[model samples]
Target: MIQLKSLQRVNPRDVEAPKKFYVQAVGAGKTDLDRLAYLISNQSTVRKPDCYAVLEALLHNMMDELREGRIIELGNIGNFQIGVSSDAVDTEEEVTSNLVRKAKISFRPAKALRDLLQTVNYKKVS
Candidate 1:
């Protein structure tokens, strides 16, 4: 289940518009690799340590591949790719690597994950 919180936000399109309450999903906390490993181990035959090691290795490899300009696709989960935010140059000749503001990893969820969203249950919280 997901917990949602109501927040008041101003509409950027109309500065004079009244602020409205919107529902935003509030995170419960975080689940670290150790917790994930334990959970996975409980659902399968793999040991927790093995699961942790594999997950750790996966993190390292995913970084390396993303740096190499390759997308890392986890069959049913999602695919991750590197993206950049840059300032626009006035001319083609003015464009340079320095214009890039930052690099970020983007994730695109698979169909299975998208379908899972349809079955999610939520509760509103103060």
Candidate 2:
């Protein structure tokens, strides 16, 4: 068996304060890059990757489209549809009703990442 590094736990104070800052101060919605930055900053020490900027831009763009009530599909990842919950139906007949009022985001991981995770083994611990 192989042993990987144990994941570090996060402090709720660290998590919630930045989310509040992003929503209140930046006004860029609840789940924006600022919030993501706060989360990522807590995880890793070295944080000067240019790829992070690109990822943030892409995420913002996706969020913008979702805000406009469009499904944004990323290649390899499943589609994201925004919507809300409707009242429970009390009829025997099947009825289609629209009750979506807010944006909801969902993600499906890429096949490549899934496959890699399924097949790779971590180095054995001494």
Tell me each candidate's RMSD, in Å, in order: 1.2, 14.0
**Predicted structure 2, TM vs. truth:** 0.40
Residue-wise C-alpha lDDT for candidate 1, range 1-126, written one tens digit per residue: 999999999999997999998999999999999999999999999999999999999999998999899999999999999999999978999999999999989999999999999999999988
Return the TM-score for candidate 1, rounded to 2 decimals.
0.93
Q: What 10-residue stretch in candidate 1 is worst by lDDT? A: 60-69
Give per-model TM-scores. 0.93, 0.40
Off by over 4 Å in 2: 1-50, 90-103, 120-126
The clash count of every prediction, one per candidate, is: 0, 0
Q: Best candidate, TM-score-wise?
A: 1
- What is candidate 1's local distance difference test score? 0.96
Distance from true location, Cα of 12 in model 2, Å: 27
Instruction: State the C-alpha lDDT per candidate.
Output: 0.96, 0.60
- lDDT tens digits, residue span 1-126, model 2: 235443334457676443321111122236756556666767877363544686778888988998888888777766777757665667747445553444346666668657767775555322
